[model samples]
Target chain A: MTTITQGHAAQDHAHDSHGPARGLSRWLFTTNHKDIGTLYLLFALVMLFVGGGMALVIRAELFQPGLQFVNPEFFNQMTTMHALIMVFGMIMPAFVGFANWMIPMMIGAPDMALPRLNNWSFWILPFAGTILLSTLFMDGGGPAAGWTLYPPLVLQSGNSLAFAIFAVHLLGMSSILGAINIIVTVMNMRAPGMTLLKMPMFVWTWLITAYLLILVMPVLAGGVTMLLTDRFFGTSFFQAAGGGDPVLFQHIFWFFGHPEVYIIILPSFGIISQIIPTFSRKPLFGYSSMVYATAGIAFLSCIVWAHHMFTVGMPLAGQMFFMMSTMLIAIPTAVKVFNWTATMWRGSLSFETPMLFAIAFLFLFSIGGFSGVMMAIAPVDFQYHDTYFIVAHFHYVLVPGALFAAIGGAYFWLPKWTGHMYDETLGKIHFWLSAVGVNLTFFPQHFLGLAGMPRRIPDYATQFADWNAVSSVGAFLFGFSQLMFVYIVVKCIRGGKQATAQVWDNPEGLEWTVPSPAPYHTFDEAPLIK
Target chain B: MTTRQDIDPELQRRIRRNALMVGGFALLIFVLYIVAVALKVAG
Candidate 1:
């Protein structure tokens, strides 16, 4: 790979004719990858705050368990909307933002293969998000059926259900289009010497993730469309009165849903892989094995969907099959964790803010993974299913696991994106508050779940009050700490110390070969990787 | 430095072909899902 050098001055001058167009049209109509990436990141940030606010409402109501803030119905709406917004609106788009910004650059291409399609993919999100959020003000309020949108209970929702379903269809379209773009770009656009194996981990994971999306997103769209028909068109796809089976809905939803977990996390594994090697100042351990492990995890994810519905009742042999399949996922997941840990072993480790978050992810995501394994047992999940333990498990995975890696990736790349260094001192402060606040908020929920305090309730038994209160306090601390992150990002973008071309020491990839704050149009001429 | 035109024509054709195939497959999955669900409900 080419080393970072200050040779882009002449190229920058040559590309001035193709610099960003003036004003709003630059963002609206242009297909430049960097501009589109900025749009995705900014949109995800807004959704993060919007979703985080709903979470605070949930916590405040559960602070003492007597419906302190909102009615039970509205509280259910909050829970439902929170998961939907976080999963669909925030996390997925943020990774797409990363893919948009880095993939073309890493592979030494000018832009996504389908640039207009890229534009369309991003433009769809805001409208979809607006339709979703607008449901809160509808006559009967937003979708209260949880993000899963299981039938029967979901069918009981009012007019907002149709609007919510429409919004989901739009969101799925955006993902499908976006995934197609990534797959095409990665398959087609690599530089002359950049073989598939030599491509960065981020690109490889996303390639796998893009395939997973293409496969499962259509299933989700179909499932929700069935929900729509059942409610409106008098179809009984999930309604028992018309001889339809509700359990079938669970089977369909979790088919998309389980892989959806891997969908959210596989790119996070990619991000951590990139960050750990850079900070540790060593080549990634077992590079080929890591690739195989990711593919293994993706394949296993498709088969293990039934594990989520063990409590719904299946034959014993069926239960055993799902249980064993779910357990098998642990092998590949363990390989990734082992590879990350082995990457850091006896290396020149430093705790910069990004590295700090990566380390925290390694520790905390494992906690979530272990909880996942515990629940994988068909018998044990009967007790744990739909409890706060399930909540704790996913929150640990998403919040610290996926979310932390995104933050670490942002910090790692912010300098390259903005051409200015973020305030390191403040970044550290953000990390510690977040690290402490996330743990304090989530750890006790494990106890609450084990203690039989169910999830999605407005009120609970008196015995569960203490941990609930503690978890609430931690929630606010974590929520407010994110504002510091926003501040640091804005501060960096506005300007600080001007960064060198290689912002971090000896980070590998074609992205670093370009100038800092990479030019509006990069690699109009592809670089030979070797 | 190789511009888009400078790249091999055969490679570009392959890229176009692959993209069409992938996009078609996604559309097929979506339509197939609706069909399968419809058949199940009808039965």
Candidate 2:
């Protein structure tokens, strides 16, 4: 066995060649970061489709209402699994995949500081996904306690709940390992002259994100473990019968969930930071402020978790404190929005797919953010809480926010990946369709939510039917728009114009400095960077 | 070897390319978004 030795082995892996893996062993035992990153991404894509399929079922059931397509119980399972699979199985892992592939390259490091752990961290995922997916077919079906796994309700879930718990444990362990790997790599493995300040913003955002993961994910693991114990071993971590408050579970859960929000968006921020500067033909405006704003958002995120639980009967002081803190987040977030716009101001600009999505992100995600601030008010939340408004708010942030960034990053880098330019016409078609479909899907929901359509219900009232129909049509259009993306991406991979060494007309990063398709190994020995 | 004067010609080219491309794309995306809002719905 090759010793999973320390140091630049990871860099060696991160910078692996575009050529075929000649032997089976290269597929199995290799410690190359890029190979592993590729594996993570492919796995996430499969998981995304799987997760997206579950959502389709949820939507189908809600299509006309009256619980026509599914039993209420199965509907609950769909909601839970849809959320779980997407978050754990797809989105978070996808970002980590990008990190593994890009971080070392961005930092000019050879690879992750600890390459072997990186392997193990990614390796654990498929098995974990298998375990969770397997629960769906089991006798009692998968856990129906929602992704939150609230007590008493969670207590009533089936033997499949055990599988869900184990699956979550596996996922938590993987995330922790990945986060630890990131923390150490960023701290220890930067190129010789690369200081913390000199590091890319994506790296900076991820550094903070990694710290959040390490701090908060353990609480998630601990909470879920207690649920396991509460089921089998008679612990009262969440059981009121054992004199434990179930509400305390929300505390532990949101501690993770809140940072988890930043965890999702921070990388997207890094992506925007990268895209904005390159596309704007200028240095990023207020670079230091952008960093501070990210840190500010992260800091504000920790205190605002209570806003989610405002209706749970906290004291007035507690309620007001959470209220103010949640609203305060907008200040930093607005600072970021302004910085992005300012970077684009008066600059000669063109719109490629990446910039297309990034610009959309600022507008749509801010709308979501504004709604989130609306929800932060205890009284207002009592009205909008668990309504379609919440649905609109989150999908706005996640769809146009996180998912857009991922797509944008992919398009931005596609030329480099395949050494061929994707068809711009088809790309614009895909972009237009998605941009239209997404807004149509979520925009009407604000009205439905205001009119009192509760979330997670399989059916709705007659009044909601019109909006719901509109939403479903939008959903189908949005789903169809993605097929174009797949078509464009797959076609580009097969054949296109030979990309120049620098794919973008104004590319500045180190990745573009290499050949069109980067050599299997980049910077094998430390380059003498002037 | 480490001096700023030793910056690679390739480096300057990449920077220029990144500048124009990033800027150009930014404008296009914004216009696309604006056109999106106005195109079908505009009376």
Candidate 3:
């Protein structure tokens, strides 16, 4: 390894171009994986605040439950655009950012296999986001058909539908390109002797995630194209009045949508898989099993899209098949949960900020999962569908599940990325406040949903007043606590205690083999595998 | 300090071409949608 480093340094100095490019062009045209990753992370952070502000408006309006804030149309736009922005602009890109930064280093590659493509993939996001956001100021306001963008309803969604459709196309293109880059990088760029089984869990999870993105994003593109034609080209693919079935649209959407949920979370699963072993001081208990389980979950994801549409009046046999397939996802998911627990069993454990979030993710995500299983039963879904209960279930999964893991992963890697250890006290405070805020925000919605408060509505009867107020208070707290997160990140980036080459002593991956803050060029002369 | 030649040019060229193709496909989707909308307005 030392010889490899020395050789690379000699070669690097020969050309006098080992460092990142200077100024704006560095971000605009350069293909350095680390720089591109930084751009992605910063972009996601901005979008987080942008999307979070819309959520604040939403919770504020729902607080008193009589349309006290924005009008219902604007409220619907907020809901629709908020989901679109968070799912596409914030969560997906953030994970891709993590991939860009971490995957090459983990696999001992100097850069992404396709650096120019990497650059192109990232640059598309901001443009897509801009188009999506600009629709709000347009004459008819933004797409207000909910992020699902169902036909007829979406067809009536003012002029903003075209912008929304185009935005989705661009976003999908960005994701597919990014996925291709990841697939090619992992397959073709790993250092000699770093075989598939030897790769980090994060890399494995991302490989599966990229495949999921590739498989489902196109379905979305196709489904939305059909909707576009129906709206503008007089096609009746999804219009019941013109011999087309609206339910067919739901079928197409969820086929893409269900896997889309996993596409968001599987990377979080990978992050947690990486963090648990580090904090617990154990090799991941079921590495091979975890890999197989992730693959199984991905396969199951494609089959169970109809579980989301149990209320759409499918035949009894169709309902039964979807319900059972949905429930079967629990097996692989549980295998993962049990494996994490077993990895932690009787290990020398310490509650660092990242570990704390990972543990919270385990408990809360499982709660979400159990609720999902409950909803998977076609009979029970009749009661829960389109209700606040459904809202509670997904928020539990996304907020504490994927979002928490993302934060935790950021904390875990901050030292390596910035060459500075974050403020431990501040990190813990951020974690605790976020945990409390999240519970307060989403927990009561379960009761509200069971009590028949439908989702996507701005106002509800007074019967739902108390819990709504409680949830609103929680949303405010959660929203405010994230400011502390942004502050922590900025403060760390500006300056902190200089981190060591190996940030966490116990973790065994190629990333730690490089210097803290890494280098402009890493693994240029590949290290021997063993 | 590795020079430009140290990088894989063939791979880079392939990625650049493929990326443009994907970007073009996305552009095609946008064009098709705009045409459909325009046709609706015109007809």
| lDDT top scorer | 1
Tens digit per residue, CA lDDT, model 2, A283-376: 7788889888999999888888888888888899999999999989999999999999998998778898888988988888898899988998
Q: Quote model 2's TM-score.
A: 0.88
Better of 1 and 2 by TM-score: 1
Cα deviation of B1, candidate 2, in Å: 15
Better of 1 and 2 by DockQ: 1
lDDT of 2: 0.78
- What is candidate 1's TM-score against the reference? 0.97
Off by over 4 Å in 2: A1-20, A528-530, B1-43
Model 1 residue runs over 4 Å out of place are A1-13, B1-13
Per-prediction TM-score, chain B alone = 0.82, 0.68, 0.72
Every model's DockQ: 0.58, 0.01, 0.10
Residue B35: error of model 1 in Å? 2.0
TM-score of chain A of 2: 0.94
Summarize candidate 1's per-residue lDDT along A232-277 as a digit string, tens digits.
9998889999988889888889989999999999999999998998
TM value for model 3: 0.93
lDDT of 1 at A102: 93
Q: What is the C-alpha RMSD of each candidate to the true structure, in Å?
A: 1.8, 12.2, 4.2
lDDT of each: 0.90, 0.78, 0.87
